[model samples]
Target: MMKTFLIYAYSAILVLGSLPQLRQAKKIPDQPFARKAKSIYRTPATVSRRVIEKTKSTVTVSGHEKIPDQPVLFVANHQGIFDILVLLAYLDKPIAFIAKREIKRIPIISKWMEQIKCVFIDRSNRRAAIKVIDDGVESIKAGQSMVIFPEGTRSKGTNVQPFKSGSLRLGTRAEVPIVPITINGTYKMLEEDGGRIKAADIELIVGDPIYPEQYQGIKHNQLASDIQEIIINSID
Candidate 1:
């Protein structure tokens, strides 16, 4: 328990200590979106690495090279908070997440998310949720990849839950590729420990991209089932 506390204390220190990096956002006053993406990603990426190392967890990744250069939608199952840390640390390109609206109130962390183009969905409000989807579509067109946890909430590393079909539209509507991601073992880190942190091995599998053109007439729920099957099969 003490170890977990110290690790999180270190995280808070890291986030607060690195706050100055936000000022670098203006370095190239008229910079393009890609350069700005780098500025937004740099510090968070470093912090994610540090957090993973501090947790004493090892993440084994496979097929990361399959991730395309062009903007694509990442459809991954949610495990827990560490799932986000692992992705931010290892995924090669700049990617933003579609997260819950409540997370936007988190100090310092939320500010960084805004800069990275994260879209916060208010699930309770249909209009707001639609607006979030529109925002995600715009972000992808402007050159940033996005990740959606279609399960809507983390399963805490247990059996994967059914995916909600609506979240898949961010990729489909944008006409970008949808990449299925399979994650396992994250539940053992904190959730399994009753909120305490423990070291564990995590496996991340990146499946092939599903191009929009290939499924022109398919229903969203059917597509969700197919991707869910892919993720379930990929897990250890």
Candidate 2:
């Protein structure tokens, strides 16, 4: 327990220590360093894969061939923090995620996230969320694919929560293909019962990609519901 706590404590300190850099990145969104910092964390994120695999975790990936080399929007259900790591470890293509703004406060990981071109959204402010989407659309146009968790937060259970239509606007506005991903066992590995992180094998199932053009003009709620159905079916 001491060792585990120490690891987390160290990670926390590292994350907290990078605040100045993060603030700088926030101010100069276009600076190369803003995005470059995110790549540095890939080394640690890679090590994280070894840690998961060391615990005998099993990951089964499907429909990867469907991932077109041409950029598209990848959407998935968020169950735990491990979801990102699992996807990163399994997917060979270089992609970034749309994450919560708070994660940008973390130490070295924040820089890596920015460097990787991940878009961070501040959900509390509607205007900020819209601005973030505008930026995401620009990122897609620039040829970088993005992953978003429509659930908005970790579900921490088997039941699929109602998808938020607000978040779907990004994919549709960007006019990129939407890839629905189903991630199971992540919540189990990082249970909400307590703060403890457990080691467990997780399953990642990717479904057929949905083209945004097909859903053009569709109501946001309907679009979200459709995506949610597709993701849930992929899991089963």
Candidate that would win on TM-score:
1
Worst 10 residues of 2 by lDDT: 32-41
TM-score of each: 0.95, 0.80
Q: Residues 25-128, candidate 2, lDDT per residue (tens digit)? A: 55654544324434443454554566456445677777788887666778789888778878877765557788889988865676767666788988798898
Per-residue accuracy of model 1 over 110-168 as CA lDDT, tens digit each: 88887788999888999999999999998888878899998988898668999999988
Clashing pairs in 1: none
Pairs with steric clashes in candidate 2: 15-107, 35-114, 35-115, 36-115, 37-111, 37-112, 38-111, 38-112, 38-113, 38-115
Candidate 2, residue 154: lDDT: 88
Q: State the displacement of the C-alpha of residue 162, model 2, in Å, after optimal TM-score superposition.
A: 0.6
Off by over 4 Å in 1: 26-31
Q: lDDT scores for all predictions?
A: 0.87, 0.72
